[model samples]
Target chain A: MNPAAPRPAEPSASAQAVTELLERSRALTTPALRAAVGRLAPPMDTVAAYHFGWIDADGRPTEADSGKAVRPALALLSAEAAGAAAEVGVPGAVAVELVHNFSLLHDDLMDGDEQRRHRDTVWKVHGPAQAILVGDALFALAGELILAAGDDATAARAARRLAAASRQLIDGQAQDIAFEHRERVSVDECLTMEGNKTGALLACAASIGAVLGGADERLADALDTYGRHLGLAFQAVDDLLGIWGDPRSTGKLTWSDLRQRKKSLPVVAAMAADGPAAGRLTALLTADAKKSREEFEDFDEAEFAARAALIEEAGGRQWTADEARRQYDTAVGALAGVELPAATRERLTALADFVVVRSK
Target chain B: MNPAAPRPAEPSASAQAVTELLERSRALTTPALRAAVGRLAPPMDTVAAYHFGWIDADGRPTEADSGKAVRPALALLSAEAAGAAAEVGVPGAVAVELVHNFSLLHDDLMDGDEQRRHRDTVWKVHGPAQAILVGDALFALAGELILAAGDDATAARAARRLAAASRQLIDGQAQDIAFEHRERVSVDECLTMEGNKTGALLACAASIGAVLGGADERLADALDTYGRHLGLAFQAVDDLLGIWGDPRSTGKLTWSDLRQRKKSLPVVAAMAADGPAAGRLTALLTADAKKSREEFEDFDEAEFAARAALIEEAGGRQWTADEARRQYDTAVGALAGVELPAATRERLTALADFVVVRSK
Candidate 1:
């Protein structure tokens, strides 16, 4: 540290701007999201309401924690960057949110996740059949919402982007499932899978606003690249939190990812590392498989915590943290090629920083 | 007696025309369907290929039993009815076939069905996770294929119809699930569910070609009506087959739907009959429920056969047969309102007849 340099002030201007933008975006996007979901069939409508944390399992209205609305915010912000009214991007925001929820609903079922947002997942509360169908409904509704936009050209372009992204998202999910049964997954393969599973949707969300706002292809593509990198950074941060974050903050059980033996980015990278720690970690994983099924089932929280520590010792934690920073920087750099409004650029930079820095 | 009445020729003119139409439609539509599915990412692409019986689970190219391609034929025929060449409806055909496969994939998972089209279902072969994902991929691809059509209006209209039908289909599936837990379901409710589950997609298929062909709303809607009633007739025939069908011809085990205790139309109607036979059927059902879980599990084919006989004795078989004919008549009546080429009209009539009479 430079002895002459003063400490930065608290509540930095960028942080304040991001917080306000998130707040404003959510305020506008939520209503549109709700309206779009309301168009689902009654069965899906009920499950979706519960899944979105807008209602309790009994169908009574309740306030529960929902997601941060980052993708929707990106859609609206991208529209603003293209010099269009943010309100014009509301449908795009709604479409992205719907697609996001569709993936969440189906992914939770496929992954057998029991809890989300500190509440029972839709599959747990409503059952897997309903969860599956509602997910399908939401996927269809996402397209319907985009087509609801008045201009045929805009709707067609937005729908095409979403359809392409969804195909990539499903492919990514298939790859993820396949990776589970595999003993080895290359770091490159993992990154590509993550790009498709997470990055594709975010890229679509970012480009949707531009497509709807009639931005030129170059600017839209640039924004999409920015979002893809941002998504990579976001996922890396999520992987770190999965292993190290407090359960209370993360809304999951202690060492949840470790207990499930999820081949998350950091773990995959560490497993591929050429070091004693990597060998030891591999031995531990193989040893667990060799144990009696009952023994594997009886493994405790302490064992999971130890596995997390061992992963960190293998250099995974630091590697992923550094990777997150690199991706964040690259994402921010992509914005430089496009001439966005000053405020839009500031908000986007803040968003990129937020993706890597959030606690949960 | 009508012994003096002459028997009609076996292969009626309409039947001959429809057979030729179906064959021609398949030749055109299969290529388009293949192209659309080819766009899916790997894993899903592979599973989907297996599901469509184009390949084996080991990815070897093998011929397998696929569905009758009825929906695609209806789509192309309807396009012809609306004064467009069959080639003009290929996209609509592809879209309907994709959606049909999507439903089959998900429904197999939900129902825990082990076999389809004389082979292991996708869920059984590729695992449920991949089946679910591949279904999702097909659904997305369906939308993409429709939107890939050059005209914005046609794409938007076709996409909107598909989205609406998907919503209804999901709702019907939910109702079918709900009906399983109930002691009794009325005939009206069963009809409505069947209409949604089967009719909605068929209606969309029938109307899509017309919509894309720029047919007037009145003619388009009439064809849709025709398709809906045909679907109802088809379901009624399916219920009849569930209890009385020959296993060899149906490609299913003896009384398969009865073994599963599906609340098929005939069963629901029989349960509501005002007769002593209905009382006996009710007693049989209650007796099955009253037995211990082990005792229920011990019941064998004889018991299932007895139950089927009782249902038939209760007049379910006769009522459903009559209802199928009623719906078939109504479907044909709807077609009479729409002007069409004689060949197209003959093909449509043959299709409606075929739906009610198909053995598998």
Candidate 2:
């Protein structure tokens, strides 16, 4: 049930392709990347090192448990799907991964949660000020990395897209902080916020692949849309699993969204309720500190179960997940439209499936 | 009496050229930079507007303050000193000025400052998160701005110098922060820290200009040293004025550093307790809250007289100002060493003098 173990795709041909796709990503992040990453700013040198599991908390070299480089994998796969090889996307892949890690470090701090990827969050270990600077340094380095790629035109366009994405992300983060103070959350409202928070960078990731793969603006835009959909689906599924899945399996505590009063998709959807469970949940939440941790825990246990039922009843969760799956499928389908090698197309489709079906 | 009025300079031929040199920096910024700042990211867009006084607290457009654009002036002047025309250093000028403002915004926030350039600080209105983000966006834009410049090699070199200086500045800031937690200070420590905190960027300003102006690396390095000296001198003079000058003339609260217990140059120099004044001052600071505002105000009323007497006793203020002037002259002399048009050389010399003598 642990999400950390490397998963094998089924014995089917598609599964073998996905396994190869994953391997391609892993292989592409070769020894040269370690040398390249060494040239990054010290702030990121440390943060990236830690995030990649090159070193443990005491600065010792544990070199274990960095998350699957999913974004980079997608980038490489998309490049292959566009008929270019993985080498074309390698530099851009590193940049995309740096951006992804940068987001994780900052978002973890902003959200005030402790754990990330089965370890203490950067802020928990480094403190917020250092963590914030680390994130900033990483962000700067990410843009710099993108700027360092191939030709004048390619690097310039990539840098522009990356900078625009970075700005949108800051705006999205501002909205999230604002969200904490508001009383009501609508489905559409959170959707836009989620899109900015998650969708923007994913879109950029896809665009980067297309750009490196030599796709034109039209195809890049399509890839961008594909990435956007994939990101939305990824976050929605993540939110779903957070409140329902086994902690041991997901490596995240269940009912954490409700316990933390996080403005997640289901929570926002559940707030629109007008029935018995809704009243009970609202009164329980509003009733205050008189509610014991045991009581609150008990409430969350039943409430999330009811909330899951309510999500189904409202057609909200199903629709969102369906939309997410649709995006995933479309993202995979978009590969077919681009001129690509058969092996590359097959691998990309499998990677897309592997992303959604990820238990963690 | 107007803070805006130009300070009188020595009537040398070089001095006569100063006004025109200063004017050229303004020429570089206004129309050209008007379009540039408009395109910055939000936290940065708002900040670029704020630093330039194009917008107010509510994000509404207001009259622009046109901050003398000193950093840009320094850069362009360095280029001029090195025989490069205005067009040659335009991007460096804009980029350095932007960086200068970025640092100012962050420094003001951490210092709990409420005002800047006779206007409310960005953080005083937009809050710290936005302020932090604004500084960050400016940093990003600063890097991007370099790319839009003279040639690929020059742009790359400027970026390298800038990014390196940025790391040094952060290190300096961290050291400055460390100085606060430990209740000790000395003249040497103050000078080095201030050199890093303020002087580094000022030095970079001149260096960027020189590099862009096609000054040789050795000459650029010399200008950097010269600029650092000027920066230190400028800061020392500013500290003196901050404590004793008329608020109307300085556009800052009298004894502002004393009131805030800021570890400014004079305070650092005086911490050696060269006389009874140092001891009494230290006692007053440590027991600051116990003192009546009237007592502090009376000390303020007597500050110019007290500071003059104490500085004379310690030979502190005179030594610092003399040291500053020495550096300023050295910086200007480096430009003289460069082959230059006599008039352009004169303007740079004049600009150096202007930097030391400006009231606000």
Candidate 3:
């Protein structure tokens, strides 16, 4: 939401205030979600609780490490930026978070990645059975959370957009999974998949914020574009770091993408090349049935270097970063179109940058 | 659902008319669900289309081995029984099916089941990620379909019940998974879990039927009971055949339940028994690790025998069958409570018996 004119307080209070506002956002969501969840089909509480990270195996609370709550921030910030009342944004907070969590619950299962945010993926820990239910539960809750926003036709419109975006998100994830098994992946196809996978929810987040701001479809569409850019930038940076960043800092195995022969932009371009580097990469990737860790590690190093070289030669890496900047510019352009409160717009811009700049 | 009043009719006409009516049900649901699936949700159409057995991997019309249309049957039957206008029950038919399919999508994932109705389960083929997205897609459609019952209020209420039931179904599935690892799984717990897992949706099917009929809460409650009893009876019969029935006929691996150490009623009772029988049963169940085919075969024979012996001794199998009978009685009692045509009541009774008496 737009920051109000300075309340004669030092700037030092901003971070603490932001954290507390986030905490309040979460607190507001819990009861609202709980009430909505209660109305869901029976036995749904378990899935709901698990998705929220409230209960472990025995259904007891140990610790909570939910995601970064990025979507909610986008939503509330956009709403406030547009000068919507704070109360109006509070409930939408739940809608955005629910949608975000729902995606996570489903995406983890589809991606087949075993670890997320340093925790055993829900499916791995609780089995796919519960994970599926958990995802379904969140899906149901997310719909109700938005619908229960009741009278605000804008909110309802926002809910419809959220649903539409969810469909795109699902489709994007499918392309990503398909990319893993496909023989060749073009940059265009990868961009399309990444947009759907990452951009859809972020767009919904910002769009919902605009709706809360009483912005018309015109404003909402622009905000959607803004979020889409943020999402694109987010993925591009993540891909870059996946190969070059400190492994410990990134919290992922070093050269793990190359070792796994992931179809990331660099690897795909490198593999498409018809040179010794490509041949070596292909030989390592398509070798005999079995592969040992030592062999994989050595191959991973060579492939990583080759792919980096290919990225430079083809300008693929720069191209990705440039696209991110285009998205960023588009996002900023959209902000200019809206007559939002300056301070709130500034916060949203910062949040947009934060999306692409996260270390882990 | 109740049947229409009996009347003399030519055999050819009756058979022809019945086929038309059955096809009519398919006609109502197909479009509602299909329209809800957008190009954005790629694998949703794939997974859902697969569940219906409508398309092969490449997405083409095949022989539709869609589920037996059980939920729709109840809706239409209830509507006909109540003599409600077609407009009322028609949308309910679509709603119930959507809810049923939505549950099936998640249930398959939660159970870690690899196949369903002779096809690869959603998670197995599409992977958990797409399976989850598909399930969510189905859920959104279910709500949307329910809300199609004319006007926001009626649709909202109907959708609310469905949302509630979806939660319970998920919760029940979670309890089922949790029971798998627990040391002591009481008979009551299994029964309760089964109720949530199976009965909740069945109850919802009938309740939706009543709602379509414009039946009051009492009538809806009666349908709910009928659905609950029928669900339990259905599970009891399934458990019975899991051990004693011919695998060729049932199309399941013979005595697969025992091999899996499933805590069916007889097994639970046997485990709860005194002395040697209980000890032997405990020894078999506490070993959840994989078993040799021979060991499994031995356990199969022993489990079948032990269950029969316990059913004979503790009267558990007889008790289970009796419970089935009790549920059937309650269903009939529920039917009695509803003010439908005499012929309709008889048909519902016949259907109830058919549900209980079936071996497969």
Q: Say which candidate scores most in lDDT.
A: 1
Model 3: per-residue Cα lDDT over A1-360, one tens digit each: 111111234443554555555565566556766666555443456656656767675678756676666677777776776677655665566766776677787778766778876767777877666666667667766766666665535535656676667767767766877776666787778778888878888888877866766777887888888888787777776676666657777778776566566667555555566667667655645551156657665663665676566555555555555666666667777778767777777676666555554555
Give the least accurate 10-residue stretch of model 2 chain B, judged by summed lDDT.
B1-10
- For lDDT, candidate 1 versus 3, the one ahead is 1
- Model 1, position B144, has a per-residue lDDT of 83
TM-score to true structure, per model: 0.90, 0.74, 0.77
Compared with the true structure, all predictions reach lDDT values of 0.83, 0.67, 0.65
Interface RMSD of each: 1.5, 4.4, 4.1
Writing each residue's lDDT as its tens digit, candidate 1 over B130-204 gives 878999999988888888875877777778787777777877887898887777899999999999999999999
Best by DockQ: 1
lDDT of 2 by residue, B1-360 (tens): 111122354555544466666677788766656676777544456666776788777778898566666677778777776677767777887777766666776677665678887888887777666666666656656766776566656665666566556655655665575566556677788887788777888888878887888777887887787777777767777776766567787777766666655677666666575677777666645565456657665665465355445544655555656666766766666665556667666565566676676665
Winning candidate number (TM-score): 1
Lowest lDDT 10-residue stretch of candidate 3 chain B: B1-10
Q: By DockQ thresholds, what CAPRI class is model 3?
A: acceptable
Candidate 3: fnat, from 0 to 1?
0.38
How well does candidate 3 reproduce the true complex, by DockQ? 0.28
What CAPRI class is candidate 2? incorrect
- In angstroms, how far off is B353's CA in candidate 2? 1.3
